[model samples]
Target: MPSTTPAPSDDQSPASRALADAVREIEHHVATAGWDAPVRVFALVRTQAALDAEPSLAAQLSPETLAAAQAQSWHLTSIEQEGLPQAPDLETLLAGLSWPATVDGVAVTAERVVLPPAAEAQMPSDPDEALPWLLAHPDRQDVRLAVGVLREGSTWCAVRTRANDSDDQVGQGPDVVPGLVSALRATLA
Candidate 1:
């Protein structure tokens, strides 16, 4: 699905704008498949660079994807990673990853159950007991955190909560979810 991402402001750096577009695009892409989807990862690269590397991909992409990619000079193309290994947490999954030189950046989307600060204080201390507590929380919100980081350190995040779910409602900024941004940066480092 095409995203309704806004053009980054004039004050923003080129890297920041591109990463914002790429991350938001991935957020909408995953949203199209519905909620509760598995963690999805992607290798980000310049659209022209990717086409140069693999000409056959031109034939594989949909007409819209191809035209939009080629039309924008700074457009980023996301290559979704498949067969991801199971991991207990986002940190663990990312700690084991490293991208190749060809990849300009990376992006990942994961679903999380979020709650207000007050709700966290009532949670169980034990991991085993925490599952039920989290699941049964009355104020729980389902959120998708889509974070992207460039090898040069630019970052962008898109956050969507099920309660106010809509492409237009997705929040976008550099630190909307800082912890996830840092984790994504670690993978690039």
Candidate 2:
């Protein structure tokens, strides 16, 4: 005798659905604008006026954080670029960088390195110290990674840089880059 049960689907979860939607949105924007465009970054803002203008977004807003009368700002880097860093000069731009006071969050689509738990555990407490380790790690060779973060503690990342390249290679979820994301988040915190 055998039981009749359907296997779960990947997009069945709310989080999964959100990721799918976000990736699609980014892809559509890139396709419409052309592939050779430079990476663009936008500021995420939240305000009572915005909430009032779009009642639907009220559900997405953090009530506790928005209790004040002022507007809040966050940073979102476009993930539409064909590759990480976007421009040749981007590496120089990111070096020894300090975000502005108005930016409470950061979201970028640059290539990132996803480390194993053992590797993550070895990361230094200081981001400056950990940076060298991340750059020199043997596993980081020929890998593609992307990360996104929200000030409210929402983080997502993806990895797929091997021979088997496909749409699915751009995986996304909160489970990626706890250490690295935390380090980046700390900068803005």
lDDT for each candidate structure: 0.85, 0.45
* Model 1 lDDT at residue 134: 98
Candidate 2: where is the Cα deviation over 4 Å? Answer: 1-95, 98-104, 112-141
lDDT of 1 by residue, 1-189 (tens): 122455577688777888887888899989999999888899998887788889998898788878877776567889999988789887899989988888889999999998789889888999999989999988998999899999878888888988878988888778777888888788777
TM-score for each model:
0.89, 0.41
Task: Report the lDDT of model 2 for residue 154.
Answer: 57
Considering every candidate listed, which one attains the maximal lDDT?
1
Please give the TM-score that candidate 2 achieves against the real structure.
Answer: 0.41
Which parts of model 1 have CA positions greater than 4 angstroms off?
1-7, 62-73
Candidate 1's TM-score reads 0.89
Q: Write the per-residue lDDT of candidate 2 for residues 39-88, one digit (tens) a residue.
A: 44322233444555666765764665455423322212232222334345
